[model samples]
Target: MRDANREWVFAQRPDGEPDMDSFELRESDVPEPEYGQLLVRVRYLSVDPYMRGRMRDAESYAEPWSVGDVMAGAVVGEVVESRSDDYDAGDVVTGNGTWGDYSVLDADSVAPVDPSIADLPAYLGVLGMPGRTAYFGLLEVGEPKPGDTVVVSGAAGAVGSVVGQIAKLNGCRVVGFAGTDEKVEWLTDDLGFDAAVNYKQVDDYGAALDDAAPGGVDVYFDNVGGPITDAVFPRLNVDARVAVCGQIAHYNDEGVPTGPRKLPQLIASRAKVKGLLVGDYVTRFEEASEQLGEWVATGELGHRETVVEGLDNAPDAFLGLFSGDNIGKQVVRVSDPADD
Candidate 1:
């Protein structure tokens, strides 16, 4: 174990969009585990869009981070010291952890990682929270059915990618909206999305949707909200189900985002729009995990990850999310696993 630890701390709140000035890397003594806790050496740190919401000083499902507080997110790590009977030294686990080389986590809070299932970082992506989000959010909230036209925004992203694939498995016609042509091809060619629109290249999203989803959208899994979502609203089929996941398009906005009132369209379509928070389905996480793991193991489900090296670059990885820098899950590799 190292004698010192390096961790990122929230330096100052951003006025609009955040940059390096928003974080500070600090060195401190390595934390020791207390009873019912374990000291883990973080291997991979997850950088997600939802973390951007936590940076703001506002009331939300997740508690906001205060100035000078240690940055926290999901991490896959190996236990170096244990004070609980459930886990032993060298056991790999994942849970809420600080953005640092080492973090002390409650044993009860983390789940053991099976490297045999997939790569360690996969625990932070496809086999972890993001996968679970796509599974429960799409199935329970979206309620896609056979022959339904399912549209996913940010379709190349961690959650959105899985949403499209799962919709395909449910016998639905999947159409996706992505930023790059490469991502669009990956969705349509590799992931089996029936159609994919490169929002960056398309001058008119409504026209793109007209060509891609000619039958109208029956289920809309929205990860990026804004113009793309605006186009989708008018194309909703009757009794459409819309799962509002992440609204990355406005995460960094300083003021209220002004857009076309979508309620009228919602009324016309009689759509059921619901916001999704993965934590709300915590009790059923094991069920989702098992099903997702089975799909991943059998090669029925596919996933990708964008990895940044070192803890120092964690802030950069996170900031990149707003700019749409990742094709799939974005993570920072702090260190390699012991067995690796």
Candidate 2:
């Protein structure tokens, strides 16, 4: 049904970190879905640090890829045509889609989203995987309580935004760490975080954290697992919890470097540090969605997206994530699905 197509495939392997040439855009036939599948025109494509791991051949939670394949990430699109009863024409949905304009997917693979509650792009951000990541990682794993002080690194990104808000909802005093002062302002100003530290501006992270949260951290939401996390590890209160969500800072590292050991922090604090994958909480997606939607509807929750126009800018937008160029959720507007 398409007259023109431009799709990006992994062009070359990255040596240390990825660059624009790592992806190649080429023309192709617009794909159509088969039975139990829906043909969707991608509207918005998400950019996340977890995607960095996918670019590597190293073993991780998800499978790695060979060269000359479409890189995978979350995408929100409109169903132009459907071979299943689940979706109809013009229905906006979000799911695992490649970096392409138009693609076919099993209807079961994507979740139907209602635009009445929020925008379609939000399904790929605050109300989607990042939402679920924050929901389960905080409540289920970190177990924040009323009056607890919660501290989250990468506080301005997709998952961190929701994590801070949810912590506020639970009556916890929230402090956050971000790469820039602007992000720090957004966290404390718009997101209801009590205190935020611009990590780049701070000289000693441990001291700055102490100044922000004089009571010590009760829940540690670790996103950047390098120095920022190392600083927070020693500040956890007795019986405190830590949710190890992401390590964007180290994604580009050629090799793991040794640092000052903190075995004593682990024992003395008696803190629980747990690594989580969003897929593990698949059963609770509906529950999390319902609550997040309710919060959004009530205006208790908010999210931001750094949208990059055009499909061609996808690689640059993704590349900017490591450098802290995005404010909240990073997305590429591939094509206008409404025109279809």
Candidate 3:
């Protein structure tokens, strides 16, 4: 075991887009496990759009990260030492852990991870929070029906990718909007989307959406919530359901940017727009995990991951999300669980 631990600490809050100055990579002494706690070496960590929101000094569902504090997120790690019966050495686990080389967490806070089930990094992506978010938000909020025209924004992203697949599994015609031609092709040619729109190349978003979704959108799973969402409003069918999962397009905005008023369209269509958080479905995590695992095991659900090596590169991986640099979930590999 190493005597020194490295971590990313919240340094300065960003006014617009986050950069290297936003966080400081510092080294400290490794902490030991106390009573009912276990020491784990972080193998992989997730960098998500939601983390951007937490950086701001604002009131939201998640508490804001104070400057000078250690950055935190979902992590998969291997326990090297334990002080509780619930966890033992050599056990792999997943939980809300810090962005660091090592973390001492309460045994109850982490659930055991089985490497035989899936790839280790998958726990930070498909089999973790993003997967659960897509599962509950799309099925429960969007309530897609058979033959429904389901439109998804950020279609190539972690959560959006899963949403599109689940909708397809339910027999819905799926349409997706992404920023690049490559992502659009992956959504349509690979993921079985009925149609894919390249938002960056389009002149008129509403026209593009209309062309892709000729039958009209019955269920819309929105991840990027700027022009794409505005355009979707006019194309929504009556009694449409919109799952407002994430507003990645606006996460970096210094202030709320004005957009087209589309509430009237919602009223006219009698549509329902609901925001969701994965934590809200904690009670049903097992149910969703079980089904998603089955789909992955049977090859019904497919996924991709963009991995950034090294703990020091975590910030780079996180900033890449806004640029659409990742085709799917962005994960930082801190170390190999089998290594020290």
Candidate 4:
């Protein structure tokens, strides 16, 4: 076993957008597992936008990270030392873990990973939280119906990609908004989206959306909230359902963000809008996981991952989320499982 561990810590709070100064990497002793915990060597570390919210000191759905606290996220790793009967030394697992090379996790909180299902990193993405979010958020909150025009903002992202594909499976006409032409192409060509607009290139998002979704949006799955979202509201058909999955556009704002009044439009359209958090569906996680796994195995659902090479670059990978630097899910490769 290694004598030392390296981890990232929340060193400071950002006034607006975070920079390298916000984090500090330090070395420490490898923690010993308690009676019900297992020491696992992390192989893949998941970097998600939600982690940004955790950086703030204010109250929200997730607990805020205090300065000097070790950063944590979903990780896929191999158990190296076990203190419980539920896991063995060689068993691979996934759970909430520290942003370090090794983490001490409660055995009950970590689930055994099946490599046959998909790649290991995939457990942090398509067959993981992001996948579940898309499944429940779109199906339950958005309530898509056949022939309905389903529109997704941040459509090339981990959750949005799945939402669009699931909408297609339900016989809905899917349209997506992506940052790059390449992402737009991937959505329409490979993901089977009926049409995709590159929001970055378009001078007027409303006009672009009109061209793609002329029938008016029946279901809007919003992941990036800003001008793109403002454009979507005015185009919503009566009885439209909106799933407010994320508002990444304002995550870095220092003060309250001001935008066009959308409540009036909502009243006119009689649209239902609801915010979603994946944790709300924890009771039915197995149901979603089983269905997602089946879809993946049958090639009915497709996924992609952008992996940064090392833990040293994890911060860079995370900050990239704001710049739209990744397509699909972004993860950091900490260690190779073969080395274990």
lDDT of each: 0.93, 0.88, 0.91, 0.94
TM-score of each: 0.98, 0.97, 0.97, 0.98
Candidate 3, backbone clash total? 0
Q: Which ranges in model 3 have alpha carbons more than 4 Å from their true place?
A: 337-339
Candidate 1 per-residue lDDT over residues 67-158, each given as its tens digit: 99999999999999999999999899999999999999999999999989899888988899999999999999999899999999999999
Greater lDDT among 2 and 3 belongs to 3
lDDT of 3 by residue, 256-326 (tens): 88899988788788999999998899999999989988887778888888999999899999999999999
- Candidate 3: worst-modelled 10 consecutive residues by lDDT: 111-120
Candidate 2 Cα misplacement greater than 4 A, ranges: 337-340
Greater TM-score among 1 and 3 belongs to 1
Pairs clashing within candidate 3:
none
Give the clashing residue pairs of candidate 2, or none. Answer: none
Which RMSD does model 2 reach against the true structure?
A: 1.3
Estimate candidate 4's alpha-carbon lDDT, on a 0 to 1 scale: 0.94
